[model samples]
Target: MTVLSQLVSLVFGGLVPGFLLGLLAFRVKSRWCPRCGESTLAMPPTERDR
Candidate 1:
């Protein structure tokens, strides 16, 4: 019973949160455009800026 409880805690407390945080970090770090390496958050420049 103790072993089973420890296994459950290790999986739920460690593995699950680690996986979720890794996924979030991957998404946040991977949102840049491949060609220009620019973030998608900015609006494209207008003709006036060209």
Candidate 2:
């Protein structure tokens, strides 16, 4: 039981937060792209970040 609970906690703590952060990053990138007149598809989310 202890091991199972730890595994569950790891999944929620790591995977869930990473997924949510990625979603927020995507949203911010899209919102900022138009200001530079770059096509969102051409500019990678990581590249526009610079």
Candidate 3:
């Protein structure tokens, strides 16, 4: 019972927040496009390479 509780806590305390933070970071990063008003990740490599 203790082990199971620990596992649940670890998932909720660690993985959940980590996943949320990663999602937030991705959203923030993708939304920032000062140059072209589009996600840089969506740009073609050739366009950015030059």
Candidate 4:
């Protein structure tokens, strides 16, 4: 029972927050495309984009 509880704690404490942080980082970086390196902007550009 103790070992199982320890394992569950480890997974929740170590893995869950890490996974959530990774997802947050991914979402933030996803604004810029990896191939073209262009950022997704919320507002339209005032001038034509080159």
Candidate 3 worst ten-residue window by lDDT: 39-48
TM-scores across all candidates? 0.59, 0.53, 0.50, 0.64
Better of 1 and 3 by TM-score: 1
Pairs clashing within candidate 1 = none
Per-model tally of clashing residue pairs: 0, 0, 0, 0
Candidate 2, 7-50: lDDT as tens digits: 99988899988999999998877855567766566544576687
Which regions in candidate 2 have their CA more than 4 angstroms from the true location?
32-50
Worst 10 residues of 1 by lDDT: 33-42
Error of 3 at 5 (Å): 1.1
Provide the lDDT at 34 for model 2.
64
What is the alpha-carbon lDDT for the whole of candidate 4? 0.88
> What residue runs in model 4 are displaced by over 4 Å at the alpha carbon?
47-50
Q: After superposition, how far is residue 45 of candidate 4 from its true place, in Å?
A: 2.7
Give the Å error, residue 41, model 1: 2.1
- Ranking of all predicted structures according to lDDT, beginning with the best and ending with the worst: 1, 4, 3, 2
Expressed as tens digits, the lDDT of each residue in 1-50 for candidate 4 is 99999999988999888999999999999899788988776866566773
Give the number of the best model, judged by lDDT: 1
What lDDT score goes with residue 4 in model 1?
A: 100
> How many Å off is the CA of 42 in candidate 1?
4.0
